[model samples]
Target: MTCSEPARTTTGRLPGGLVTTTRRIRRTLAAGPRVVIAAVVKALGYRLVRVQYHGTLGEADGAVPRGTTVFDDEVPAVANLDPALLGALREAAKDAANDGVEFFVNSGWRSPEYQNRLRREAVSRYGSEKEAARWVATPGTSPHVSGNAVDIGPSEAKAWLSEHGARYGLCQIYRNEPWHYELRPEAVEHGCPPMYPDPSHDPRMRQ
Candidate 1:
């Protein structure tokens, strides 16, 4: 389907928590005959298994150290990002490069496995899964796993980008995570939920 085509089928809740339009259910039925019966049954409100994030599978170990660098231990695969957003990020990076600001992609996409590993490690180190979940969003909840979010900043370029990033279609979601930005448009009317919401007034908003 084209990008302009509506991605979501359901407008309201289904019998279970599943939500989708009758048209989509029918289409799926017609396209995959073998699974048609099961699909129809699922359409009645059997929630589909939560999609596992597959983006972080190939990430190098210790790509991002535990230090306070802008990078995250896991990120979504860059290939999954919208083409337009990816182009915009590259352009933004190039612009920064021209200004003599060295920037790198500290984190991009993350797979479910990577997120789970981080979660496990956090619990092991911090002695609380709750603490781990707080610091790192549970797999599916992470924007980095969407491949549309990135953290960017130089040791000194933070201030400059803070003033100019929006021009490149990037916005900082959390004030505390000054290095993190995503390709969310100023005005988004359709498609999936934004990777990052505007930071809240709470000091712990980023975490």
Candidate 2:
């Protein structure tokens, strides 16, 4: 899932834990440049805030390490995907690799709890449920939670998929997120369906 941009307003107080963490970080960085210290503190605050917002996730929920490939059976993110869809992705990845392209799984199957956390974070970032709906789907409506969707990464990989994915039944599902893909077995013959502008425009999300 995409991380929300750091909140724009600077008026709110930091959480007590975050405040204490910041002081500790500042002391640890006493000899660092002013700019570097400030940046580090900000980054730490963002991470702690996310920890508070999303709790914690582990392998069972499909969290995977960086560079996880479609063929990695040991990774829950790759293993828990719908079998047919996973097969298509593996076939596509194998072909893509011949051309020096690698498919890295940025996200795959997610638990409902993780999906809900993401939706709530999106709402906090965008300031309303209406706006957040354009990006994050509700837990019950998210394809990721149902093992039917995958978000791939590395610009070259996404570009390669855009050009050749449909041949393997993998198709981009949203106009705004080229990284997001789903399996459409019919796409191998007739080509993929039209793209939704965003999650908000998808009929499946209304359910």
Candidate 3:
């Protein structure tokens, strides 16, 4: 029997080594969509360590300072999101507050680098990229990186948003991730579009 080398050893760093790393990424992706995400995170150990110590890669990477809220306009994670998305979240939060439900920003805008780290970590925790897709997404396709999505928290807040969000253009994007939401202005009149089962089911992720 033969053993394949660990994926990490096969990957290389940038400035001169991306060629090898990128080829590995291509080969892993070509194998199947499930393994594709593992390749993207193979060489991210150092950056992931930096993220752990600093809690972020800094404002340039759309890192939300700890304890960020929907109203924290000064935080990059809140400020960097699409203005319309921010507006909708703020509006929904205000109403939710009236119901004794305060919205906490678990995640908002993210730099592509941060998104990649999350995918890498998810893959590690879940034991495979295929399962990770149920939670995290690749940087290129993550709504958070695009500033179009937010992950709110607190069971009460999620419940409040689930019931009242559409009136303000905030709608949960995935059935499995009830805390995740995106702005859809038309929802105010027509209601939100159907939810995707998970990130993998969203057609946008393929791109």
Clashes of each: 10, 0, 0
Please give the lDDT score at residue 198 for candidate 2.
94
Give candidate 1 regions above 4 Å deviation.
Answer: 1-77, 187-207
The top-ranked prediction according to lDDT is 2
- What are the C-alpha RMSDs, in order, of all predicted structures? 17.6, 11.8, 14.0
In terms of TM-score, the best-performing candidate is: 2
- What are the Cα lDDT values of the candidates? 0.56, 0.85, 0.82
Per residue, candidate 3 scores C-alpha lDDT tens digits across 32-106 of: 753554445554332122113335577668766677898998888898899999988888888778888888888
Error of 1 at 120 (Å): 2.3
lDDT of 2 by residue, 1-207 (tens): 223556444455668756876666667665656545455646554421332224577767878798898888998888989999999999999999999999999999989988888899999999999999999999999999999999998899999999999999999999999999999999999999999999999999998
TM-score rank order: 2, 3, 1
Question: What's the true lDDT of residue 199 in model 3?
Answer: 88
- Selected candidate, larger lDDT, 1 vs 3: 3
